[model samples]
Target: MANETKKSQKILIVGGGTAGWMAANLFAVHWPDMEICLLESSDIGIIGVGEGSTPHLKFFFDEVGIEESEWMPRCNATYKNGISFVDWSAIPGFNHYFHPFPAQTDDIFTVPAFFSSINARMQGHNANAHPDHYFLETYITAKHCGPIPTENFPFGVAYGYHFDSGLLGQYLAEKAISRGVKRVIGTVTEVILNPRGELASVRLDDDSFLAADFFVDCSGFKSLLLQGALKTRYTSFKENLFNNAAVVMPTPMYGIIPPETKSTALSHGWAWKIPLTTRYGNGYVYSADYITPEQAEMELRQHLGLLESDVTARHLQMKVGRVEKHWEKNCVAVGLAQGFIEPLEATALALSFNTLSAFIKCYEKGGYSNQFEDAFNNEINARFDGVRDYIVCHYKVNQRRDTPYWKDNAANTHVSETLAQIIHFWHRGGDFAKNLYMNNLVGSYQPKSWACLLAGYGVFPPLRSDEHNAPAPSLPDMVQLGDFIRRCGLNFSAHNQLLDHIHRRPA
Candidate 1:
């Protein structure tokens, strides 16, 4: 086979939402000579109402040569510095914190100081370890400013976006089509598989067959080709993650718009408030086993002060987990078809890009053979598990005791051995970061992320007698750090002004 002549690859993508278009665009950008045709079903609609992303999204747009001005205005997009978590911790002065994305200047000095303070607090020393003041993005978000630095600022900051998921799909669809990617709209009624259990072609409702050298299943959760055709086993993370449903509604947008997503703790689960230029998207993610859908919607309505209003809410069910193998045979699954881990971290798009990137590299490395298939699956599944551990940590370390859901989450012993190891070493306050890295325990997240999520929730032990009155030298200099952050914040523009600037620009 190594001596065989190389031929161009033909890829058929079955789905049209953000995930599908994303796959189409990435394929076109990566392999210009490949025949990429995205087959979409008009009957299926977009899943998520509003969406946010990790820093990886910015990299994706840059790679595709789509400027912020090109897509943001059309999609009602807004800059997202990071997620601001409120009421996740009941401890006073610790009830709210902003988890900033990685910035250029963070590692210079703040991260080391931040980690030092966390270790100090865990060691019975009176130290301020709250995450709100440690990172520059916190101050930028606190002041309702955009993430883009001004001309005078020498450092850079990583940021994502909040956009209307449906509009974004259309935007990306047009972009993909303009880039030589073909679009075929038809509902898939049947998936034809070869005797080898590999995807051969798909039968549409019109009884027409479409075949390709390779297939990508982006048909949402039904997994038309990968799981439905290949019978790939699905793994459920229900053991540690309990929220199965989400109710979404939109609230009126007014006043200053912060360049960040707001996640507030709720009784059954957490509520997300995402700001878009047109309106604010709000949703409550809760467990159906604990609360009914109607009850959840009512709670969300009340939370948004819309109990008396006639705003309708859309209820969505989440199938949380991944498949046994992302790339089983000749077909690979992306987006909802691949698997899900909830949107706690807004990682769907990022994860999708990462999968395609990894698959392309691995597949090309093996000359489109299945040589690296197992390696790709192992890497992607571990990535999913890593993110799950981080999200599960949020619930496990939560200070809430009002609901049985929270109680059960904290008491549940279903966590992986890797997570338990990190937690066990966290409280002891030794070289935990070194231990995590040395032991290969740090999967997708860095030590700073682990520290941020845990320390943001005030996970330190109680203050001892002498520690309560511990000397000031051991504590972080909040006064000086505060001055540094606020001063640096002077460079960024207001969140509203930045969006308006983009909106005013000619698309």
Candidate 2:
């Protein structure tokens, strides 16, 4: 088999969501001489529920030479410092916690204190290890401040964004098309494979064929190229991760839009509240095995105080897992066509961006051949599994024992060995960070993130009554810590102020 050079290569993207346009834009920039074209159907409808992003999205825009000022305002986007999780646990003071993206300041002060607190608590001493108290980002979120640190702030604060997914896809499509990437709006009715069993081209509904050197599958769950055409194997995480359905609803915005997505635990699942400039994206994610779609819709509506409102609910079924091979033959899967570990961490776009970035590097390194596809698949599979482990940790260590869904999650024995070992190491007071680093288990989420999830849920042993008079653990002073956080908070502006400034600029 002969490989084509970049100048002679043409890449065809099957589907047009955020993933497709992102692929087109990335290829246009990275392989400037490679011809890239994206095909999408007007018949396919994308979910309009507002979507949240990870910090990676900001980097994605940067990689594509787009500024936040240009994209955010057009997408009805709002700044997001982190996520505020409420009512996931029933422990007295642990009912609420904010999970912030790690900051550079964490290394100097907050993170060490956090690890010490967790270690002390593991030693049977009462040390406050709540994650919300130990993060500068949490303080910023609580104060409703944007994450852009002032010029002299000296420390970097990571942030994401909340946006309407549909609008974002459209915006990216326009940007890609303007940059010489061809956009063909047509449905792919058939896939044609070359004699080598790789994707040769796709047959559209109009009885025409589109050929390319490589194919990218962004065709959503139908997976027209990778799985459907290539026959790639799909693995399911249903045993450990039970949530497979979501019901989304929109509500009008109110005063003081905070710079954080809010996730609240409900009976059979959790509800997410994503704040955007135009409206609040609300949704309930649950397992249909334990609750019906109607029940989930009612629960979401009631939870959001919209039981009587005429707003209709949109339902979705999610496939929770990843493919055994992300890159197969000459085709690579992106977005839903690849895999989904659920959107609990708002990682959909981020994962897609990462996968595409890695694929671009590996594919280019191999001279457009499949030389490094094995390594790419290995790395991506590990990433998908790692994310799944983290999301599963939220359920496995949840403090609620009230509902069967949660209880079953808590007692489920289907977890991966790595996750079990990590949890066990946490309980045994081993250095959690070292465990992750030693095993090379740290993927996208950091060790502090794992600590946050555990400590935020108030997972701890019973405090001993000094055991006939032992020394108390020297803990960081809460008052002093609070003051330090407040002092640091002065370097940021109010969420509304920043958003207004960003929005006021015309895109």
Q: Write the per-residue lDDT of candidate 2 for residues 285-354, one digit (tens) a residue.
A: 9999999999999889889889899998889999888889989988999999998887889888888998
Clashing pairs in 1: none
TM-score on alpha carbons, each prediction: 0.97, 0.98
Predicted structure 1: clash tally: 0
Which candidate leads in lDDT?
2
RMSD of each: 1.7, 1.3
- The reply for model 2, stretches above 4 Å from the true place, is none
Best candidate according to TM-score: 2
- Overlapping backbone residue pairs in candidate 2 total 0
